[model samples]
Target: MSYRSMTLLRFCSPIVIQARHGHRMRGKAPDIAKSLKERLAPVILDEEVAKRNDIGFPYQKPPRSAEFNKRFDHLKKQRSDSSLEKAARTTKLQINLDDVKVDWFKTAGPFHIRKIAEHYGVYDDLFGKYAYFVPRVFLDIKFPLNEDTVYPVYNGNKVHPLQAKSVPEVSFEHKFALSYSQKPEENTLWTLILTNPDGHLTKENSEYVHWMVSNIPNNDISKGDQIVPYLQPIPPKGTGYHRYIFVLYKQDKKLDLSSMKVTDLKDLEKRTFSTFDFYKNHEDSITPSGLAFFQSKWDESVRDVFHKELNMKQPIFEYDFPKAYLNYQKQFPLKQPFNLYLDRYADPKDVNKRYLEERLAKTHPFEGPEKKLQFPNAHELKKNIPSWKKTEIRKERLGRGRINDAV
Candidate 1:
């Protein structure tokens, strides 16, 4: 019977089973009928739609600063220098330097920490520039000047850029606290160094080591080894304001810097030191934690320091800043290109062999009326300077040099 039924089924018509909702049979995939490309195509999602709308970042960034500024400029309605002071007062970011707590030196939030760091140029003055490592610990500086001190900072009560008149004796002693330890046993060993970065501007301008104390078991100075005996600030005359920076590095163990100690005040080689180099030499064990700075200038005490302590005649520096060219004609607009020349215009110094050998020579003819300045633009050079402006500007002071650079 089964053999007869199979022969009958082969001769009969094939019966098709209709799947529900026009779907194919369970064994077949709907995409099997489509082309290979359609089957392999990626599915577009919400994220993809967002990407097509240029909503997210690009895969490759070509321009950084330019593109970033352009993209964010529309959002920057309240610029720092906006004349409309109340334009976005609600969104304005301001910090009160006076509100800093002394305990914040030991425990402060990141925002407060950054404010403190920027206020004192923690990175700029010491680390050379913004760097990977900025000292979290800060040295609490106390300079008993004639009128002001660096202690108990309050009400923007930090040390002023220029301290009142004071001699070397006022700064001979430095008070440093490694830890605000309530007990002596809780205190940690620390290394403190003070250096003046004003001698020469090339090597660092390298820091002139003023004072260094190492291997202090606690805040006590007498317990520490005086690596470089404390020398009072004696900035040479003519040198502008000098910054005396104090950096406290956390010591893992007591350092043996007795061999590097400087007993001779006249020894310039040992005195001219590099804080960064010293840090690098022992960086693995020490991390800079504290930073503070104060400005010092030449005082009469500097004379005695040079004569007695250093046993050398003090070097006098003369900063004869040339008088700036006054805009005598206030009626005229002097903010023109020719102002670069006129702004810094100064009288040429009297000298037979003044500047250029070719110019002012015996054969060099006297100035002609055509020697007048022919500036590229303006109401013309008539309103401003004539020729020899370049020569004159060279002799001008730095204040005028900025004007030249601006133009």
Candidate 2:
């Protein structure tokens, strides 16, 4: 009844299965090819070329805060997504309160930049103004010591050495001279500003203008007009480390300061300065280009600079640490052992062990209690000696009985 029909069905089944398999393979071919290309792509370590998919590196990183577009702006198209846009695409931040990874913040730094000829500095190469990762140059803030120069570090290394960027200490007497990696363009001027955001209690907003120079032609700072003559950082003693940041800005044109308020150069109130307010007022023209900062703590020179140079009272900051705990609380690891580790998992509204203990003591009067042990007090022996001068009266009494070795 079915021999002839079964033979025809078997022939059609093989053809139908082959056609379905072919359709499925065709549908997945494009995705498979794409993944294959990505897997097989070569990494070029010698030179940096912008990639369309990655926006972390400078070539891909849509140019300065435009983070570094001062020159790299041309490298990335204006139509592409901005750095902030890319940052939002990150569901979770790669760096956190505990970690120190700035590369994951999607900013890439210049690498392998050589120092300006004859300049004996490694930091001059750290920010990479010559190699071009946005920061046009780094400052060579030379101190008395060779290693005190501020160096920038941003090569996407596994370990971000933030301390490398800071100068451990700087002197008050020497005004750190800055050298540039490259000169400004013709007719273009530069401005060098030194500010201390950690002025302790010195300023209204905690910012102190250490130095300011405007209209510097082609990076020769000596030729510029010194508006706020370099005030050697007079951070009040005990103020800790104050970061003196040197920010260089490129002037769109010559700046006219006639309208701006010029505080009397000698006035200590001139110390109360705001770099943001200054930048806000001149937002139209000046563009931040290079940055280098150093840290300085209170030294003896600060006292002399305050009293002798500024002709004012030397502010000494002595933090009076609150005196020792006279009445201490019985916290764990202090006076008691922690037995209830499960307390952490208990409900917040639930009664605590302390309250339960007090309740139990009230209900059953603690059964019975005794305070029977006491040592003879040194104070009782000497009619009230203070703790510091108190002698071990019991030990002295015990020693009197053992006179075998007495001289």
Candidate 3:
């Protein structure tokens, strides 16, 4: 959300007070939840704004999918040979996955937002209304942006220009008084209608990029969405932090971002990012914004630090953070370090050594195959069946037979 839009939202939010209680609005679905669903939804049209902008390459044309790859490959071939279109084609920003510096997936949370206006001397602001936080689990990927560096798709500061535009619009309100038949009633969502300050919207399919629905409540102010109050501080060595990016928008009409599915949110996020980029940098004077990428390894020590900072219990498994994290324990263990839940990837050498040791332990000398066979009841039975007894019986039977035959 842009600064100007945020200011406007803060100002107009007061008008919401006059809205009739339970008065149904015409056109759109009455359920506020419907808006909430589309708000964080993905673009799903055959052609999006990004794809239209560049006929050659469709944004997020699934690389693995045959249809996407086919189009992408065909477009690449056309661009390579078309010298006339080279300027525009080459101007687009390109990124490699390897360039990212920090890689993490965490639950979202709302932290660091000021609970009260500084002017109020730490007292909650009277007009404030909105509770917001990032989810507890999310993928936090960061791309470094350097000052004074500008790329076609990314601005300086080593960050993508698209990211800057995709910032979420945030607001607050309180609806605790609203009666609910459900035991756990839903919190009121305070929404801010935002626009592309730079006049750039999604090119092909208007992509919905960033979204965050948090449980953060506002105990400070009354009026507006009061779902999020305050962010809880996890002690250092904490469980890690999640940042919710609220990209708010007010459209002239409802959007079909979701196409009616919860899983579609991912596509919506990507589209939102792309749309923000298009609008933010339409003029080329400034850069559009979006996340670049991050390359981080699974480190137990880092996980421990997160735990300590968040005031969480120490985890038992310490070999690696991502590894132990992915290993699901039989029980839903108490606040184990985040590392305990991450998938661990270690050098092959270490794995081989462990495997051999386990093998040897299973085949130790006392438990060897030969010793077990000799000590068992089979050995006693064999000893009891005397070979000499069997031979004597056979000879006695033969002698008796010969005497009978002679008679």
Candidate 4:
């Protein structure tokens, strides 16, 4: 065969032709097959396919039939009802103590007097007086005087001797009274805390804890561990009489004494104690059971006793002696009743009403003119006056007009 004829034959052979166009033909065959398969396939609905496959489509949702709509509405109602029930469960109601007869309060006795007598009765009985003749003016309304409650006893005496010359030693036996209703259980515990609220004579606020004991079983304070040792009262020479307050708390359980910051005698002076904060922090654990107090002034006996027993130096009379005391006495006279002293001799409500009236009168005086002129409308004024002058005149007229119209 001729070379030209052989070359043409080789190029035109079926196998050679197939190799050159095989890839393109294969690619077109898939597309053609896919189109043909789609045309011949069954018309399966989305719902049918989802049901058959047990699958959910993200973009395609099933038709909402009556049953579905009813179910959805029921679900919404249930959720709303659940939310309302949750709100009802979480809501708290405020209780007014004055409006309610609290059995606990009655069993506790006159809250204030019971507390004071429990702590100070010993000193008062020993000193042959009721609460050191604490003037009614000095007594707070929260702690009204109640003569029925029992008091504490110190060194076999009912009264607290205050004569500086015969200031009692720090080593004195102490006892407390049990409430008639306080039938102690196996878990009952008590705590005794002694504090001087007026540690800083110049300032009206200060706290000096003289002693603290905790975990006394069944109101037996003597059985408790003394967290802070007892210290004799030593008022600064010039700093008016100091009220040494003793308070007792009924503990629901043994306290975590180690958590207390003021654990030693040295820590007492550095402590800034708050009875309210203490009770708040331990609300679930402790309740105030009793309280008592006695006033003490600087005397030579107190100085000598403090020096011998505490090895503490006498506080120097930095400020004038008796002057500050006299001023306080004058400010809170014994003759003045507690309510009058607290009110400063005027009704606070009346004062507040007068102040509000004066302010309102000044803010909206009644003497202004009853009739006020109205300015021309902006559209009407624009026909006669320049725009700038119109604005200025409008502002001026508005300012001059009575504001009572708005009121």
Ranked by lDDT, top first: 1, 2, 4, 3
CA RMSD of each candidate after superposition: 25.5, 24.4, 33.0, 33.3
297-390 per-residue lDDT for model 1 (tens digits): 7777778777876787888876687576575644355555554443344344322123333233423365521242344233223436645564
lDDT of 4 by residue, 147-171 (tens): 4433333211223223322211221
* Alpha carbon lDDT at 65, candidate 2: 50
lDDT (Cα, tens digit) per residue for candidate 2, span 1-407: 49889888878755344443433455456735667667689866533333212111122334235446543664555337476457767754243632232333223322322122113222222222222223444444432324444433222112111322222221111111123323423455777777667674644544676677788776566777877766676667766665666666777789976443345755767556766567658868876655555555766667767777678898878677645534333344443323332333344235354444543453545554233225533325465765322333344334431121222
Candidates 3 and 4 compared by lDDT, better number: 4
TM-score, one value per model: 0.45, 0.41, 0.17, 0.35
Worst 10 residues of 3 by lDDT: 120-129
TM-score-better candidate, 3 vs 4: 4
Which candidate should be chosen as best, given TM-score against the real structure?
1
| Per-residue lDDT of model 3, residues 1-407, tens digit only | 69999888878844345555686567765654467667779867554422313111112222247656876997889677666476556885444453331121111111111211122211111111221222111122232234543222111122222333223222222232211232422343222211111111235323222332222233112333322221211112322321222222222222232322234321322223333333233323211111211111223443443354324454333234343234435345576433323213445455556545544554658766222233232222344656654443343344432112221
Candidate 4, superposed: residue stretches over 4 Å from native:
1-187, 201-204, 259-268, 305-312, 318-407
| Candidate 3 segments whose C-alpha is farther than 4 A from its true place | 1-171, 174-243, 249-272, 278-348, 351-407
What is the lDDT, from 0 to 100, of the residue 220 in candidate 4? 50
Query: lDDT value for candidate 4?
Result: 0.49
Q: Give the lowest summed-lDDT range of ten residues in model 2.
A: 169-178
